[model samples]
Target: MKNIQFFFLVLNVLIITSCKGSGIPIDTETDINIEISTGSTVNIKIWNFRIDKDTTLLNFPKTLLGTYHFIKNKVNDFTAFNSKGEKLNIKTIGNKFVIYGSGDLNSITYNVNCSDKTSINLVSSGVIVDKDLIVLNNNILFGDFIGENRNYKVEIKKGTNFNNISNQQVYHKNDSIDIIRFRDYKQMINSPIIYSRISTNDTFFIGSTKFVLSVHSPNSMVKASLLSTILKPVTSAIINKIGFVFKDNYNLTFIYDEGLNEKVYQKIALEHPNSSVYHFFSTPSFINKRDSINYYQDLQQMVAHELFHVFTPINFRDNFDDCFYNDTLKMSPHLWLYEGFVEYYSLKILLDAGIIDKDYFFSKLAEKIYNYSKYVKMGYKISLAEASENIYDKSNLNIFYDRAAVLCFLMDIEVAELSQGKYSLYSVIKQIYKQNNKFNKDSLFFKMNSIAPGIDNFANKYIISDKYPDLSFYLSKAGLSYTMIHKEFGYYFPIKIIAYNSKTQTITIEFQENISPFVKNKQIEITEINNYKVSSYSFSFLYRRYYNQEIAFEIKYIEKGVLQSATIKPILVNVPKIPYYPNIFINRNMNFSQKRIYEKLFEK
Candidate 1:
């Protein structure tokens, strides 16, 4: 997900005896009622919200990704009136419209309908309407917010046809409607409404926090229960590592793309405090599409990343840009903390859970270092602090993700060593979560330093200065090593096998060139991968589910009718002919200090 695409709303929630949202007012509540009607396709027939304050203008959802067509495609029949039931005239501005006369505008109403000429977007979200399902960004649909900081008392009038509406935070008022209260406008807008003729639901819990998984897909194989089976254990491990920041119910909306709309990029998941929505493309629509070793691994990583977001700026935030969050032009310099830290924790927690191995972890770390080098070579030589500020300038969003991961991975190690292994990055995160403090841009790092000293210096180098240090030194803290292979890169086996001969009960695979010192032949993967027998998995599953990572396997061959397995702990090496990043690996021999640090990799 693009950090820029996170032109998200921040409803600074206040907690008693806590430091969060100290200066922000969140007590005010707006009363809203929505009635949605649909036929061949989903449509918001008529919706009205009551904003008590006198207001002359209305705004559609706005975020930093640029102008959204919410006003043009999802809104119409807009009208406003006071308590007297008098009609009010409104004039269109640029992306917003103005109420002709200023009064205590108690009521505003609108309906969603795409003009015959306007194009609709389903793949990349905000607002989408499909034949079997309808997913609408509530903020994009319910346009007016009296105050950006106010909470909401929302009532969605659902007819009998709304039986398939997303099942989270629902308080049914009868057979026709459901009532729910949001802590802030941010929660209401970011929490989308999903309805599908073909849908399924699964609910899970970690601690007191409840989560409901709702799926809307044409593919019968894409079921909420199936995904829950894949996601629950990993999620439990993550939340177990870093306790759930909030004790509330959340909905995870997973929408599968059946090529019903134009394909955009890949999977897109937007995170919120209480809910998150995902758009799946290239994901296995059918569970049997991938080998047992990697069933939904791609989706697993993506969900883990999005899930970790709850701990970042959501609970731990720099409230400098509050009201400007949606369709915002303002950018925060804390993208490193917002995304970088989350990415680090996501991957680490996944590793802790065995959802991913150390080989994958080390590969990702090296890849980030390589990515940082590429950007530096391209004249994008700036610290994450600067890049985050100018994220839209040189399009350094990707750089932040790469550089930030590199920075945090190293920082986690450095932090561990600095405190004599007392506090890792997650330690700093948990302390921040407990304090419930909102950081200021200038003092964010200093505040982190107070939590775990030396953070400010780390920030000065990787975030505040244009200095990318020797990553090898940091990896060494935990008995790890890094290096690069200069070779050509090729396709990885999605099935992790090429051809299988059931008659012989044997498997065969091919490689363009041998890049690793461990594996010598061009086509020699004769036996096992990650300890799983190669013959057990399907030889041919079509879509690409896994990406650029070294595989750990063994080259087992039959010699004189005796099964012989090579000693090489293997990773397929299809290195690009061009220069690449360092590869991280576990060092078998380590000093006492290195062993202590390495043992703490999963300390908490």
Candidate 2:
């Protein structure tokens, strides 16, 4: 009876083996198949080889992104199993694991125990595989990680329904999961997919290259339309004037955060024009339903700034060494060319487009100048070139942007003067663009020397060398001057107040501190600045101007219910100032002759 039972068991095993598909054997030559599930589990299938002679291991990378300097190897929670479903012995080798095969094994399988329920957070850039390494080259502003000659394949898991992804093949299995595939690393790095519930439409262009907007936020359509309309003309102008022949295509993407308000979006859009892609987050604090006009205007400015990158350093980089790299942090030294020139054009494009009047443009320039003065006073001023080289240091990032713009303004004036009212920085850039080659620090230096041999020394001393130039001297050459104004004895009061509403039409005293006897029982109202009746609603505007300055104010204070008047002077407060062209319209008119000269040099 026992022999009969054994025979039956062997016969059943043979039948089960026949029913299975072509299975992988151990201790034979074959390829390995790894199946990674979204649930954080991995299945390994071996073919034609025996499991007894093969080993499997799972591991993690040693470094994270951005920091770039730190390196460490640590991995855990790994296990292996055999065809019989028996657990195998495992040993750790740094971040990897070593598994012992039963005998001449041809197949193996292992599982990686991850704590996260989703696989999104596990995705990373800058991967190192054994002797192979992958790095994204950042020298060309719009360049991608994959080179033109290389080709590879990537397959994303399905069922996670991430939508509106461009330049990628996506497969959907359900609402929560999807799979994406890329032909190579270049495609993956150059194209960044933003997944959000908010939906919006956008317009994009680089010469004949047109992009339709794909956003998740529904409320962003209007703003996206505005951006599309504004950028169309500007991009057309750039392409018409300068043909696109380089490998880098200036590809960029804009991602709007439905939670971000108009003001914050405007700030980000204006500031980060050259970013490969901008993700604008809309939070409760940034957007409000009541201020649609302001919101629209802010969106226009954001679009203008972002689109401007196509013409500036993005297309006309300073040189190869100045380019960005993953391993090192450095700044580009051609701030006068990059930011300053870009700022000048951003304003010019808006003016030429008739989006803003001449007066508004000049007012903005004045604001910049006032802001520049604060940085100058702080003894932290540097030339545009120096600022560019040190820009990514984080310790001085903020100062570089504003300061570089100021230097560009000065250089524009210098170019205008040198060419006898005939040439400007615009002409110089156009010349470089016509050359149709990548820029490097050495090439830029050589070009500057070629244009104005003596100017190189001047640049070395005032712009390139490690010293702050006397900005006042340069402004004087352009018939401008910087003066410090003081007001300390006009009238005295101990209260700080502001109007509660525009309807009030009158300033209201809000707080009093260390009250003086002369104004203790007095009701005071601000009526004028330098004899102009101060609009109560415009008090905030005035405050912005007087951020670090003391000024004389004509006040109407009520002493015991009786109206009184006094002129009070407050101490000057120190604040940072950005350089501005106080008379941009006049400057443009005066410099119009230079445009003709530039036309002569490059127009033909």
Candidate 3:
């Protein structure tokens, strides 16, 4: 499954009053002094917390990795008492905390038991610890504001030995604090624990675009060097093609885990327009080391996919809800624009950079068309617009990627044809970005038709309905075509074999589910196929030649010390080939319209 990071506004709020018998003030506002110190590798200590009100409610993330300890005043003090002579009662439910503040509590504190499970992430989220490098954001450290929103001053003390810490507030909100600490302050030599940071950060620029690139892994210096060399040139190409300029700086963090032998990159975008964080999780198997060209190609594709979001659906959509917290995977109606079209441009930027050719682009589109045909035939008849909303069923969600890609491909061709090569999907996208229009079905429908006549009708037929329209006309517009024909694809053997003698040229069979009335199940000398001698080692070629089709077979075997033969003719099965066509390739020659469409598809 493809893992992409997305941010949404959490809309959970509850109104409740605390049960009060303690002499705590109700309407009076009081200062809450919260202090956090991580001077040792043992654990994090949050102390000296003073709350003024009796009933306090705050948001707490459920994904917090460690256990919490409620203490009074100091690090060693485990008693839960306040200064006002009233006991404190605290309860945690999901992402909210209801704290019963009393007069007896002088000060309160909590300790987080850190372990290996706390990995650092870019998003300003729950408690994350990388080695001894701790990141405490907003509510995770000193709980957020409660009741009426009011700005509070927080004093954070860091160990003298710590390095690379940031506590800058990006916004003026009371809960906008973000703190990150790097490296261990006190290393425990005698302790059996990981107590250091493998992550490092530096500034990188692509032309005027600034990026704070951070790599968190051992030997990440080499990866940083590789990315720094080409970051500028690649961004220049992508910015030009996407028709959007980055007005704000961003952060890119690459995390390489050797244990995870797969290539997975996720982008965690914040609510701020100036900041975007990407987490590139990869391993040796995913990063190509055979040469620099292949490595840069893979890296560039991944980077462009994330940067292009600055225009589409990100700036185009108004709001999105937290689906996970709601216990449902409700998606934005423009998810196709979010993922499918974003992916289309991700690959298109590669071609724009000259990293890929036109032929390669067509081949990719054709592959998607072929892959999407299966869902259409399976009666998964939800319109792309409907599927975009209720995509909780992951089984058919991936089809959205291909279906939208091919849809964009066809739409571009149609617009070019309708407008006499004057407008295309690129034109519509550029207009949206220029106007900063929020992407939606109605917006796109009107915007496309206004760009060129008949474009809206084309979208209605292809995008709003569950029908899979014929793409032969569009394929021909690009000077490409595919014919469906039944051919010997492959075969699967139902019988199980114990062993085969390659040197002696003998086969030993142990099990058979429904062996044909041909050869016996035992050690047999296989010598011929269709009366032809099998000494030339043409088994692979012969299998393909007889795949999906039945043919006469002859096997030479020694039964009871005598040579025997049997002829068995099986049934031939031919399957549908609609899902296998469109193998998109360049035509031998192009007409005027075909040449126009191709130029429009790749033009800047």
Clashes of each: 11, 78, 14
Name the candidate, 1 or 2, with the larger lDDT value.
1
Query: Which stretches of candidate 1 lie above 4 Å from their native place?
Result: 1-55, 64-93, 104-125, 144-161, 164-167, 171-184, 260-263, 282-292, 321-329, 486-582, 602-604
Q: Best to worst by TM-score, what's the order?
A: 1, 3, 2
For candidate 1, the 10 contiguous residues with the lowest summed lDDT are 1-10
Note the Cα lDDT for every prediction shown.
0.59, 0.43, 0.49
For 366-473, candidate 2 gives per-residue lDDT tens digits of 556667667767777465566666555545544434555666666666665665655566667677677864676656756755664445665676566656557666
Model 1, span 1-604: residue lDDT tens: 1011111111111111211345533343333434323322223322233333345556665441211222333566677675577867778654476775444454556655521201233422344443455455655655553344445555554444444444347676776555666665555565666666677889998778787898876646578898899889877876677676465677788876533222245456677666667766433423232354455676787788878877776667776533332333546788887788887779888888888877777777787777776776786667778777666554666765787887888888888887777788878767866776676678767767997787788778878898877767888888887777654653343223455554353566554344343233445435443343333222333223234543434446554567766543223334453344478778889888887777777433
Best by TM-score: 1
Q: Residue 54 of candidate 2: its Cα lDDT?
A: 46
Q: What stretches of model 2 exceed 4 Å from their correct place?
A: 1-150, 157-162, 165-187, 202-207, 218-223, 230-254, 258-276, 283-298, 318-331, 381-384, 452-454, 466-604
- What digit string (tens of lDDT, one per residue) describes model 3 on residues 115-196? 2221333333423344334443433333333443333332233222223323123222223222322111110100011111
lDDT, candidate 2, residue 489? Answer: 24
Return the candidate ranking by lDDT, descending. Answer: 1, 3, 2
All candidates: CA RMSD in angstroms?
10.7, 14.8, 14.0
TM-score of each: 0.71, 0.54, 0.60
